[model samples]
Target: MNEPAQHMDVGAYALGVLDAAEAARFEEHLADCSRCAAELDSALGLTPLLADLKESAPDPGVLIARPRPALLDGLLARVVTVRRAQRTRRLCLAAAAGVLIVAGPLAGSSFTSQNAPSHSTVSAAKAMYEEGEKIGAVDPTTKVDASVSLQEKPWGTHVALKLANVRGPLTCDLVAVGRNGERQTVTTWAVPAAGYGLQGAGADKWSKEPLYTHGGAALNRNDIDRFEVRTLDGKLLDTIKV
Candidate 1:
């Protein structure tokens, strides 16, 4: 196949839309082509986003009494739209980060004398789940086991979460509830289908890494009373108390 044709198959291969034989051929090519391998990786990372969009998509019947587009076509269009939006967001975030870096020197001068206090705040923070807590089931039919750990920092709380048997591609939100009954969103993340388990069996799975939240409005370790794991649509999945 030509280079352009092979590149075009990357998205289809990543989405599992290609036939078995075609997919096998593409995989063989991917083994030797670094550029196509990178493309495949990028496409795979968007799987969860695409899945979330699929789940949240409005029902065609509810919109109008007319023929709906083919599922593949609809999915492809959604994927393109999401990719473009993601690119734009990344550019914006990069610009914002650049500003923070430029202003870091001025900000550091203000806190130069209080560096010890900031260090102490991080050192004083402890894991919220040092003692074992039961993982609550969000869906009655699905068995999910999860554990969360938090460490307090001067800026905000750092969270580590592990989940098993929770189906994907799902978007999860970590919410921190303060002593005053105020809620703060610590972070949100996407889990790919493979993260669920092999062949849908309940197996141990860990998150890619710890997520951090910061700012005055964010939750602090001492003020937080409980943590809840919820879906993007506000469905409660599990909870852990500090």
Candidate 2:
């Protein structure tokens, strides 16, 4: 679907009304479309206040209709721009090959997703943000920004990440490039404000434990030489070329 159609559901997203698939889509879209992200941030923040305004407004006999500038067209344009950038990146990456590593900042604002998730779905952001210091936290380095928490079960590692967004969105993709140059797709979406649960090849679920809020987590010293975070369509956001 086109970007505008994809984001027509922004209202539902901000209100926490969409289902899993829908919510993920909007989160990814918001990350790329800064305009929508900014606009939604304003609108969602005002919604509660709007309810208060309704409660305190003048009686029907003295009604006042506020004049606000229309933003639909502008919002659409921005979404298109973001989509084009994503498309360009995807096309470029399609021909490239390498292993994939991912990393980001964790010290800044204590992990928080710009958009909140409902009670049903796990809050990936909060979990990753707090996982470290609680248990299985990774030690951070000077150049590195975030930490990853891992738990061993019957499968591989149960992974939760806490990273920083010093600049724009942390929205990115994961691709596992093998020795033979075969790229195994991971996944990506709008990062939750707090943390997220990763159900990969091994660990297929998140735990029910509370996350750590204080210091205890450390960063790993390994240089993620092949790690990268890219947009949905494949635009490179950050790269660790070792």
Encode model 1's per-residue lDDT on 54-142: one tens digit a residue.
55558623433222346556665666677679889999999999865533323333344447645433211112333223233333545
Clashing pairs in 1: none
TM-score of candidate 2 on Cα atoms, chains taken together: 0.26
Which candidate number has the best lDDT? 1
List candidate 2 segments past 4 Å from native.
1-125, 128-146, 169-171, 176-182, 191-227, 239-242
Return the lDDT, model 2, position 138.
23
Off by over 4 Å in 1: 1-142, 197-217
The whole-model lDDT of each prediction reads 0.59, 0.42
